[model samples]
Target chain A: MRIVVQEAPFDFAAEAQGFSRGLSGMGAVVTFSGLVRDDDGRLAAMEIEHYPGMTEKAIRAIAEEAQARWSLGDLLVIHRHGLLAPGETIMMVATAARHRAEAFEAAEFLMDYLKSRAPFWKKELTADGAEWVAAKDEDEAALDRW
Target chain B: MDVLYFAWVRERIGLPKERVETSAATVRELVDELRAREARYEAAFADLSALRVAVDQDLADFDAPLAGVRELAFFPPMTGG
Candidate 1:
């Protein structure tokens, strides 16, 4: 498993290809990428803040839980922290497994956990002003299914 | 112990982190001590329901003990993905 928490923007294509080729026995690979949305077309940038010591630890625990519950070959989670424009990528999760079901399910599980459990906080800067993005109730409720 | 704030809490408190010396046994008690320090702290911690706490870099409840905690953080609910 590979986990990265960085401020530099990652090359999505290269990372995705590297993850897929690194696995030896996996038959399926699933990837999810999150991007900052500018729904109103007024977003200036997003400032992400996280606890340096705790962010990696929390994500590692979540990834290990995914590995334990699913039969998988490997997984990768890359999250970015810092100021980013609306078009930039926020994070990505890639899961590889022997079958499609395990790969897809594990990817969804990781996404759900990352959405709420991680220590990262996002503040949206728009024309009006900067405001912290509130956590959605649906995001927390999504975890109950798993 | 080092007390940290993030997001709105940090903005409202006007600082990112500070060293705190407290005899409070739990997070709730520690908050009470902080609230008594200044009006800024009281305003920042006005609503516990909208806040989240982490003790020693781990997510913890407000009633969680702080016996050996070296770091404590307060922030709003995470909006990560």
Candidate 2:
């Protein structure tokens, strides 16, 4: 299990390459990427802020939980903090498991928990001004289902 | 007692961090004690509506005891993705 939380951009290709390094048995690698989206359909970019210690702990815990639930060989969760552009990637999750179901389900579970459970706050920069986005009820609902 | 503020909670508090000491028992008790300490704490904690509390490095509740907790953090609802 590998988890990295930093401000610099990440190389998805490199990460995918690393994920494919040790594959001896029949398996699948499920990957997911989260981007800065204009939820309000506003402008410029998104400013993401996070508590360094808490953010890492929360993400690591999520990864650990996923590993406990599945027989994963390699797991990588990369998250970026600070300012990010609209098209820029904010985070990525990769799960390597023996079967497609476990790999995909574990990746999705980690993403869902990270989005709603983790301690990251985002503010949208628009033509008008900047406003912090609230935790939507739908997000909470999504996690509750899982 | 270095009080660390984080995320939107720090933005609203207008200070990223501060330090203080008090004879509060639990996390909730410390909050009440801080609210009484000054106007800044009161304003910062004016609305516990959306606030989340953490003791040491673990996600704790307002009612969680802070007797031996080293670091205390306060923040708003998480928005991580």
DockQ of every candidate: 0.89, 0.77
lDDT of candidate 2 over A73-123, digit per residue (tens): 789899898899888999998988889999999898898899877878888
Q: Alpha carbon lDDT of residue A109, candidate 2?
A: 87
Compute the lDDT of residue B15 as modeled in candidate 2: 88
For residues A34-111, write the lDDT of model 1, one tens digit per residue: 999998899999999998988999999999999999988999999999999998999999999999999999999999
Strongest candidate by DockQ? 1
Instruction: Pick out the ten consecutive residues of candidate 1 chain A with the lowest summed lDDT.
Output: A17-26
Provide the lDDT at B63 for model 2. 88
Give the CAPRI class of candidate 2. medium
Please give the lDDT score at residue A145 for candidate 2. Answer: 63
**lDDT score, candidate 2:** 0.83
